[model samples]
Target chain A: MAGTVPLSRRNILTDRRRLVISVLGVAVSIGLILLLEGLWGGLRVQVSSYEENVGANLFVGEKGVRNFLGEVSAFDSSAVDELRRRPEVKAAWPVNTRFIVLDFHDRKQAAVLVGSVPGGMGGPWKIAEGRPVEADDEVVIDRALARQHGVGLGETFEILGRRFRVVGLSSGTRAWMLGYMFVSHDASAGLLRSPGTASFILVDSEDPAATARAVREELGLQPLSPDTVAENDRRLFAGIFGGPLNLMVIIAFAAGTLIIALAVYSMTVERLREYGIVKAMGARRGRIFRIMLGQTTALAALGFVVGFGFYLAASALITYALPQFWSHVSPAVVAGVALAAGLMGFIAAFVPARRVSRLDPASVYRG
Target chain B: MDDVAIRAERLEKVFGEGDVQVRAVRGIDLEVVRGQVALIMGPSGSGKTTLLSMLGAMLRPTSGKVELDGVDLARLPESRLPDFRATRFGFVFQDFNLLSSLSALENVQFALNLAGTTGRKSRERAEALLRGFGLGHRLSFRPEKLSGGEKQRVAISRALANEPSVILADEPTANLDSKIGHEIARLLRNAATEEGRSVVIVSHDTRLKDIADRVLWLEDGEFREINEMAVDPVCGMAVERKPETPHYQYEGQTYYFCSPEDRDEFAAEPTKFIPDRG
Candidate 1:
């Protein structure tokens, strides 16, 4: 009986080209999956992070609210005072959200207009430039929209064909459906032609459940906690973009798996004679299969490294081009991509390895 | 009696069935002892190669028994055949089926690896074998880079890597030039005689008669004793004859031929041939 030949590291490493190609295929597939997943995850995180920082204890809105961004809820302005009078409510304020077209430097751009009272709980914006919105005819624009429209502080911009002064620049705040502009209560009403009407009411209360109960009883309006508001935002986003993103991820995974499978299958077929010779030399079927799998795994590992590096460069390019669009390169995402790539390579090599193992040495030798 | 390294009893191989059936080997009974080179010679379709395959335990007989060293090969499972071939018998093909992807040394080492020999020892053994075959400098060259004779030599080294009890050569020298062919024959003969291994060669080349201890002539799926004159008809051409001789009188002339068919050929044209009275 002949003894077994232990696997050689030198042979495996020296055959770097095959290993690199296989790894690259796996890595590209996994990196694509990770990119898609990370993009989706980053969007979710941005949305939730924005909502959490808003400091809203409860949100008053219309029943069956579908689009929360820049949509009118038709709550009376007097309801704010009535809700604030409740025992559990510490403060209540009216919020006006509407869409308006802006004209700056002869360029027209559409923007979501948000209105809040001066010195109120939701009034002071996190300004990125210039001063906060204080005057009735003054507004603050998001940095992205500001740069796009070439508008600066103290510059007057026309909204809905009415001119208003640009008071400041704000950051980390955007409407769900459109780029945003922050304005005083009077200016927002003028833009919408609706006085004493707002989209929703924001409450700052220590106990949200109690305040929500109070608002429901006194004002006959449903009060939603910030968490519920975030949840609604998530549900809305998912309804609009969830199906396509999920399908994209699934298709990406499937494509990656198929690519790896084809690569491995072709490689196995090419090396069929070599495999037969090895088997004839007394290599057990299991060992041959393992060597093939190792080859695939090694290739996939190389691909993952290259793909991740490519993904990082691509993400950076995207971030540089569109600063507002979040494109994160997370280690977890890289690792997830690597794992997925490895698995794809493993699965892809499986059928071919089995075919190789089951091949008759006698027949191959005859051929 | 010495133990038979390979023994086949009434071996039969039939291909297909019904009208399309072809009986490859009718019934072959033979015994090969250790340290002897046996040659099976016949024209194509004479079941010479088929018999060799059956004896090497590479193919199963249709209705017969084959035993190697007292182990019944006919009853052995299909899965066990590879192990048996790897450990008990080595094979040399005419085309020198060396793997093109592997260097000559690696090709030999691959065989050692399959036999579960690994590490520095496998390399050392492979190097020794290659050096012994005078291929020390050609170890790194792949099959495509090597000459035909070198490839055949590497193949021979691979076959002998596991130190099997028997070596089966199927027209081993058919693809080589006369010089290389003779060299391969000498190597095979040396393996049998000096290394104490049984060698079974299937070839139509009668030049191998000198190296073979016994020559079995297969014709139409049956083995027949070959007359030395029949192997090489020209007199004094290093022919080895059987003890008995059969002669035929044609047109008042005595004709000497090996088989009945040769005698019939002579009968067809009696005046064109002279009688061999010796």
Candidate 2:
């Protein structure tokens, strides 16, 4: 069209200061949503990391035990021996896992305490420094937790009123709010007061499917694969934290929509005279609406670009400053955010477009 | 082709309802032939703007009809009105109304674009129009950068961009000094005379009468005979002579005032406000 000026672009660019402020407002809201979603993604991965990498083919728990967190499971220690005797099961070992709060220098830190037999299937897969737990008094804690609490090798921390020396600093062992603390089976048995029972029996077998079926039928206990156990752990974590995280994301989205609405509405109101002039010059309501939508979409897209950049920097800073939080920004997460921004743009354009539509074209003559 | 470019028959506009109804334009008949400049002069509360708006198809008449190019504008569907206005009528506003965001050339091109003209053709046409208006040197300047005269010239260029058959102007010279105001009036007149487009202007500026082929004086939503109306020497507002109207005898001529304040102001210094006497 001959008169198809880039009115939206020109209007937004007219006031550089206002445009920057509007973009930043939207960027902040978008950044917050991205951060929350990334944190949620990271949490899902971290919650199940240990079980996924524990090297056990299957996990034998109490009949009703669903996951390690928020669920208690303990079976007779004799079950481990019975499982090892089966030809389908190559080996079996008892492992006890529970939540415990450690007090170091009068500061309390929550952690998932894991105890297994020396050189067993269930242990810290990767040690960043020091050595694994070998003695009842020795413990391997997450490197992030150890560094956070200023605990080093040979330093003692009180767990369940018992003192234990830090033996190793394990890598990738911290969840968002909790870290992993590894100790000996005897030590965990003593700490949890279940010396004759195992929380779970770790099974190693070449024919894991046959062994799992045999264990379920003969042993009469719930046996789950490592992958199933890890997935259950993830579901448990999501069930606990999903509501709050989703609520925060929704609040961020609403804030972003309002920011776009405020900016576009104000711009439309300020340029109402020009709109009237255009209407008088034979520009239709549809054309005026297009101009408003153009401005809104431009604002949202710019904010998204800026917000994505902000998320990258902020996520890196969070990981560097507080190593416990792992923020993962995936392509799907970014695409979801882009779709949300587009929705925000459309919703924000409504109020301003309606206002322009109701205006009288003849009002231009009043000037 | 119709020699009468615009013919309005008993146009009426009533705002509000019942007791609060405002008859903005009432039972006014008007006609403008091709190449004619018709000026509608009135006081502040008169219906000149309303009539002009109706004539330009910007506002629907409460009753009666406005005919342009042998088609009754009031009968056209709402959806078709914008295109009709874009291709058949040009509007010049008191404030120039050039989009502040667009350059002088782009402002003109915007009109062509609205009329389904685009690309290089629109650009060349817009450029030629601006250059004809002596704004060739300021093609890229936004509205705020242009002087008042330059802005009005740009507005005129935009009005002429779609090659409309009729030009509807509301107070086109209200913001300019006498020199520039006369120049703008002459431009509108030339647009009518040289291009054979009929021009209808609603303004209080008496200077526009110099180029107007027909001058209509409106008061209280109705057009009165121009000879029966007096221009207030103080504010240049058209005032109808009535028993209660503010009147003063000045040099053997009876002058009517829209208000006593204007009458008092004029009574104090008749000579000072008498140069543009009507």
Candidate 3:
């Protein structure tokens, strides 16, 4: 008896050009899936950018406020002073935030306008250049947005028909469809025409649980930890974008499986007579199917390697071309794509295996 | 111990059904003892290949049974047929039937692998067989790279990989030139005489008669003795001397043909299509 031939590998490799084409086809689908997944990951990180990165341990919003992006959250500016007087509160900062479209240089940019008290906890956390906003008319905008529009320090942009000078540039402060712009609390209050009130009260306390209890029980406001606020914000965005992203991923997966199935099916059709010969020579159905699956698996594995390479390159190009749209490919994403590739191979095998199973070994004699 | 390697008792094979039915092979009985070479020669639709397929267990007979040694093959379950064929019978085809992707060595080794031989032993057996066939240097050559003769030789090496008790060849010389065809015929004969394996061949190539111990001529899905049949010089098919059978007078003798087309072909080139008996 002889050792088994690597039939699957050899069969696919027999036509080197076809194999390359098939791998590349599968690679494109895989790359698309990886790109979508990475973008989803970046969306998750971006949505929680303010709550995660701001120095506040807890956020005190108006009653019934559960999220930051879609929901309106506001409380009396006097709540900050009262929170500052509490023993559990280490520090309290009144911040007013709202979504506003800034029109400048013949373009409109959607942004989260944050009015943090000068030198307060909710101010620009990561200043890339210049100083944080101090004057009522000064603003700190996200660096990527400024660079995209060629806005620089000392340049003034109008928000809500009021002109404010760009004093500082912040990093990692953009969500999926909007960027963050920081200004003095009075500036946002004056620009939005809401006076003597704050959107949320940022609090850094010695015991966050104690402060949350005090704010909810005594001040009659909703007190949420930064993590809770971030999670709620993420859920809010996920609800908006999850369907489209998942549909794209599913389409990519189906495309990958189709590429693999098409390649294997054609190969099976071409070598059908040889398969009949093999059957006539006493190869069992199990053996024939193993060869088919082996061919598909080998093709998918090659495609995955090429796809990951494609993803890495595409991600770099995207980051360079559109700095705001970040794609993060984590280990979990890689593992998931690899598993999906294997599943594609498994699913692809059946189309051709069915053809082989129906083949008549007696056809070998016909030759 | 039984000396017969394969036995077919009133074996029949039919295709289609009802109005369109075709009786491909009808009530055929055959027995080939170990170390004997049996060559079945026939016209294109004469059921030679059909009978061969049944004998090799590649196709089940519509009726009766095929027995190898003392065991009836029909009694074996469908799942067991593959292993049974792999271990007991070796097949050769007109096309040489080598897997295009496999190298010569791997093609031969695949049979042994199918029969549960693996690793070093399989390699050694495949290597030895290819070497014995004078194909040592061609071990790594794919079928496309090999000449027709080399490919046929490789096919023979593959057939003998598991040292099967019977070797069944279909039109083994159909695609080969005369020189290579004779070489392949000798190989099949050697497998019978030297290795004591029963060799059954189905072919229209009259040259194969030189090596066969018994030659059976089949016509219209049934076997007919060569003495009761006349060979068509143009195509070498056995033609019964019936009233409607086409015949021509050549060199003061009557020659029979399976078709008027063959008769006309012979008439145009009588010397080119010389009857084997004449």
Candidate 4:
């Protein structure tokens, strides 16, 4: 019997063009999967950016607000003091969320408006390259939005027909698909034109979990931890868009498996005579089957390496071309895809291998 | 009595069944000893190849018995026949049947590995055999690159790689020209005479009769005549078989004694017998 590896390599490589096309199929499938996963990763990071950067222990949100980043949750500002009166709460700050159109340097773009108390846990934690927002006419913007509009410190930008000087720049504070423009608490209320209402309350506490429970019971406001809020927002985002992404991944995998199957099955049929000759030389059914499987497995392995390389090249291209369009593929994802390729190869060769096993060695003598 | 290497009794083979049935072989009895070249001569569909397959344990007879060195091949399980073929008999096909994916050396080594010789030793043995057949330069060539004669030589090397005692060839020279065909015939005859193996060739090529020790004529799945021997039984002189003259009988058997004097001497003293008789 022929050694399976050498025979498989020779057969698959006999037609180099065919092997390359099959590898390309696998690469496209895996690259699509990784792209979707990377987008999902970017979204997860975006949704929880504020809670993560605020360093807040507890968030007192409105009753029906789905999330803190994208939802409009307005309640009386008086809840701040009430929450701060609790022993576990060290400090409480009022904050609100609103979508407002901003005009800067004659260029207008819609931006998410965040109203917060400056120098408090509700505002930007640290400046990237500028001073913190101080006066009522001052605003702090994310570095991404600043770079997008070419704005810098001491530059005045209009928000909802009102102008505020850009005093500070913050990094990695952008929300999911929306960047923020932070202002003083009064300025936020002034922008909303709602006198004494805020969207949510940020709190610092000795024990956030215990305070959250107490605040929920005493004030009837859902006091959520940073991690809990981040998780809820991520779940909501997935519910709205994840279904389509998952379907795309599944379709790509199925198409890849089918291509591999057709290619391998045709290969086996073409070599059926050779298989018969080997059998006549006393190769058993299992041995012949292994030879077929060997070719499929080898193709899959080569395809996996090409697929991973494709993913890397695509990721680099995406980063270089679209600086703000984020994507990342973890090592575990690559391993999972490689394993999936191996499984696809095995399944693809099964029917053809069975055909080989049923072949009669006596057919080798036929005319 | 000659030491029998292969004995087939009433071998019968039928293909398909009912209206589509074809009786390929019909109860042909045969025996060929070691160091002898036996040729089954017939046209196509005469069951010569089928009988050869049955004798080599490649095809199970429909209703008959084939014993190789005293083991009833029909009684052996089907699963064991591959090992039997690998270790006990060698087969050469009309098409060469060398695996196209393998080189000549790989083909020969593959056969040796199946017969339980493996590693460097099996490779060396394959190279030695191919080299001995003067195919050393062509050992690395595939079937497509080699000529018809070289392909047959490679097939012959594969057949002999296992060192089996019996070689069953189906039209071994069917693909070669006349000169190459005669050269292949010489190779088969050498396998029997020089290596002391029983060689059986099924072919329509009548030129092989010159080198065959016993020619069995097959027609319509049955033997029309058999044991066309050239060796005289009484005086041990080589003579062509003729129906009349120098023929004698003892007990119930007839003999070709080569000469009238030898026949008369055998008739006068029936007890005195030569030990070296085929």
Each model's TM-score? 0.79, 0.94, 0.96, 0.79
**Per-residue lDDT over A147-228 for candidate 3, one digit per residue giving the tens place of the 0 to 100 score:** 8889999999788878889989999998866889998999888987889898899899999999999899999999998899
Worst 10 residues of 2 chain B by lDDT: B229-238
**What are the C-alpha RMSDs, in order, of all predicted structures?**
7.0, 2.6, 2.2, 11.0
Q: Each predicted complex: what DockQ?
A: 0.23, 0.65, 0.74, 0.21
Model 1: what is its DockQ? 0.23
**TM-score (chain A only) of candidate 1:** 0.86
- The TM-score between candidate 2 and the true structure equals 0.94
Candidate 4 local Cα displacement, residue B183, angstroms: 3.9
What TM-score should be assigned to candidate 1?
A: 0.79
Residues A1-367, candidate 1, lDDT per residue (tens digit)?
A: 2343323232345456765665666667666776667666666655554347656778887655534552457767888877777777778778787766656677666666778888775653477888878888888888767776667888886777777888888876654324667788877777777798877888888788887776677667777767777777677767777899789877877777776666667766776766666665556666776766766666667666777776677667755566556655467766776677778668766877788877766553354
What are the clashing pairs of model 4?
A: none
Question: Fnat for model 4?
Answer: 0.26
- TM-score (0 to 1) for chain A, all models? 0.86, 0.96, 0.98, 0.87
Indicate which candidate wins on TM-score: 3
> What DockQ would you assign to candidate 4?
0.21
Q: Which model, 3 or 4, shows the larger TM-score?
A: 3
What are the lDDT figures for the candidates, one per model? 0.72, 0.89, 0.89, 0.79
Off by over 4 Å in 3: A1-3, B228-247, B250-266, B269-278
Q: Quote model 2's TM-score for chain B.
A: 0.89
- Candidate 2 C-alpha RMSD relative to the actual structure: 2.6
Model 4, stretches more than 4 Å misplaced?
A: A1-5, A63-72, A85-91, A98-113, A122-195, A322-324, B1-9, B48-61, B65-78, B115-118, B194-196, B226-278
